[model samples]
Target: MLEVKVKAGVPIPLDVSFQVAAGEVLALVGASGSGKSTLLRTIAGLYQPSEARVAVNGAVWLDTGAGINLPTRRRRLGMVFQSYGLFPHMTAAGNVMAALEYLPKPERAAEAARLLALVNLGDMERRRPAELSGGQQQRVAVARALARRPEVLLLDEPFSAVDRSTREKLYQEIRNLRRVLNMPVVLVTHDMSEAQMLADRMVVIDCGRMLASGSAAEVMIDPAALRGVGLREAGSVLNARIVAHEEDGLTRLDTSAGSLLLPRIEGAAGAAVRVRIMAHEVILSRDAPQGLSALNILPVTVLALRQGDGPGMLVELQAGEETILARITQRSALAMGLQAGDACHAILKTMAVAQDNVGVMQPVI
Candidate 1:
């Protein structure tokens, strides 16, 4: 368990707190200098907190009421800085071994090799950080943090140095590591896509205060919170597959609702992707348009219909197991007879869905 409520000498007080069950990843997501790093530092004993407390798996690391402030070393925590902080002189194996000094030299070496293997870097254990790519070094840093097997792991933008392709691989590695060692991880990142994909639950923070904390679905799809962050109220994210790509710069996608067409895509045929269709992009229809330019005509059943935080109503639609959002004005909703559990044709132009609306839609870019 971890908790904190601290201020960084700012006009708006920064106060946020959350706990991670062992092996689960809880992400801190917000803008730069939102004091996300400060929150992590406070929990790690890097800074003295004016208020609040820090604990790990039932042990109290910081207690304001008891006036206890343990040194960082005394706290049982594993830290992976944004820079990774790998030693240039040390090989990947050597860096991991340093964290396990309590063990014999032979055991330390074995442990290093084991941790490296856990992260799928068994082949590069002997190579120094300088010899490895940015992604490789970050993996080494993660292995090093686990050599001693601390109760908690703190990662601050650990994948910034890596590209999207490699980052997915690292995500899998982290998932594997969590399975092998049941330690809670605190991941700090600014990218919502990364945060949504990597974290089990997301904690939204701004000005050092917590805005929302819930599963990725609950935290991100809320138009109010997104509006607060200036994110346009796009509809829900739909899981899609690149069934086919056209030579004319359009691609056919197989979504839960039905087959749809979108702008030229770069994904391999038969690859899974996320398509973001904002509610505003979808145009409703009482009857299908016979000769319309709108490419996607999804036959959807409205799961829930309610007012949106902003100007439009939030219509949650179900095509299959997947859900999507359609934002429409109150007048349109009433005129179209849009009601909960109503079946309707959700119409949209193929080109209306922008790249941002497509979650992790790859290869086309």
Candidate 2:
């Protein structure tokens, strides 16, 4: 368990506590000054926990009860900071070997090279940090951290410097490393998508306090985070069954809302999934839209309609537990006579709802 109770000279303690399972990554996510990075610092022995105990893989790193505070060196942990922190003069392998001085010299170079390959940084060893791209530097940093073979690994906004495409590749590499190494990972990040993709579970913090922690799906769709973070546009999408594939190649989905057909290419039947419809994708209709090419027509009751996403109104409707979106012009809103507490049909194009727009675990082929 990694725990903390920080006062920062305040009247009340900012209490937070959570743990990452061995070989699993638990992402710490929150807004600025939410104490996420601060908490990471505390766990790595840079800052004292003050009141709570801290342990990693059954080893006590901190215990305020007995005043058993372990120094940073003795903690047997590795960390990658937001800065990457590679030496400009040293080659990639040189940076990696720097961390393994604690090991016997005989095995250090080969082990360092092995970890570099683990991060797909093979043949980049001779390049200095100054000669490498931001992503390559990160790979060197990650390789260096793993060189110590620590039981726990902590990462603080590890991908902040890399481009989105590079970040995606690095994300996969980190996930692979965790699985193969079996080292528990604690990631502190402000990016929601990053947290969702990497974490087996998540711990949400705000104002230096833990607010919620659970599986990614549960925590993300929690009512509190949606409202608190001004993420009112965010809503949940439930699984829909693919009932049929049309001759025109459009795929039809039989959801609780009746049926929705999209021009997306067909996938295997019986696939369970979910996707975000960005409140803007939804438009209200007092009656059925005539001569429209749209295939998704949902008979929905207005749950709540509010001013949102610019001139476009946010219409929260129910087709069951799933939430859908419709972005309509204000003129359409007025002409169609839409309002809260109104029963309206929603219409959207089938082709508009791409399968790539959906996200979930892909079924094994």
Candidate 3:
């Protein structure tokens, strides 16, 4: 487990405390200049806060009261920055081998090759950073980070530099890597959707303070958390599995809520997936409507209603065994007399669930 407590007033203002369990992915989510990167730097021993305590498992890396501070080199952690951070003159293998300096000279080459292959860059080992594509270079950076055999891993907007298609591929790569990596992984990103897709739990931050920390559904349904993560980005993730692929370019998925149909999803039958349904795209009706163009509809019970300062009302719904959030105008809520225990049907367009929002949900290894 990784535990961090930081309270500082200078250079950057922050008073955040959180813990991440081993084999769990925790995402630090906030806008730019919110001190997410600073907190990550502090944990990696690259930055010192006025008052802090950082520990991984039972090893104390920093203790301000005791005046104990381990240098960055002594911290057994690997970090992948937003810039990729590969050396311009070194080949891909050379970059990874740089982190394996502690290994014997003879073993370094073979280990580098293995790491390259892990990131799907074995054939590009001899290529320089400038010669590789943006996505390939990012893979090299990941390989270099893993070469250290870190006790903890830190990813700072690692996919922000890649294109949409490349980002999706990298997302899958991370999911596959989690099977073998047992350490705590901390991801820093401003995108809420990315956090929901990649993290097991999320910590919402604003101006260096933690506003909320919980599972994706818990955080997304919170009004305060929505303030940090814009309400416009508010949504809930559902656990689903691919059941079949129809002939009309649509994939059938089974969720706790109900069966749903969407644009072709690239996964084998019985593959687990996470489908993100945006609150803004959902329409609720007292009864199941007929003759509607929307292909997906699920009967849900209203769990609670939270009215924000604005005209929007956040409704928490229980769809089967899963919880989902719906953002509707207060005016409409009053018109529909929506309240706790009210039964309704959530209507979702087949295309409203974007391909980018759907991600592979890997089983715990």
Q: Which candidate is the best by lDDT?
A: 3
Across 115-214, the per-residue lDDT of candidate 3 in tens digits comes to 9999999899999999999999999999999999999999999999999988988998898898878999999999988999999999999999999999
Once fitted onto the true fold, the runs of candidate 3 whose alpha carbons sit more than 4 angstroms away are 361-365
| Separate clash counts for every candidate | 9, 9, 0
Tens digits of lDDT, candidate 1, 75-128: 877889898999899999999988988798778888888889878899998899
lDDT scores of the candidates, listed in order = 0.76, 0.71, 0.93
Candidate 2: regions farther than 4 A off: 1-13, 232-365
Error of 2 at 245 (Å): 15
RMSD of each: 4.8, 6.1, 1.4
Error in Å for residue 157 of model 2: 0.7
The residue pairs in collision within model 2 are 263-350, 280-327, 281-325, 281-326, 281-327, 282-325, 282-326, 282-327, 283-326
Model 3 per-residue lDDT at 136: 95
Candidate scoring better on TM-score of 1 and 2: 1
TM-score of 2: 0.70
Which candidate ranks first by TM-score, i.e. highest? 3
Candidate 1 lDDT (Cα, 0 to 1): 0.76
Task: Itemize residue pairs with steric clashes in candidate 3.
Answer: none
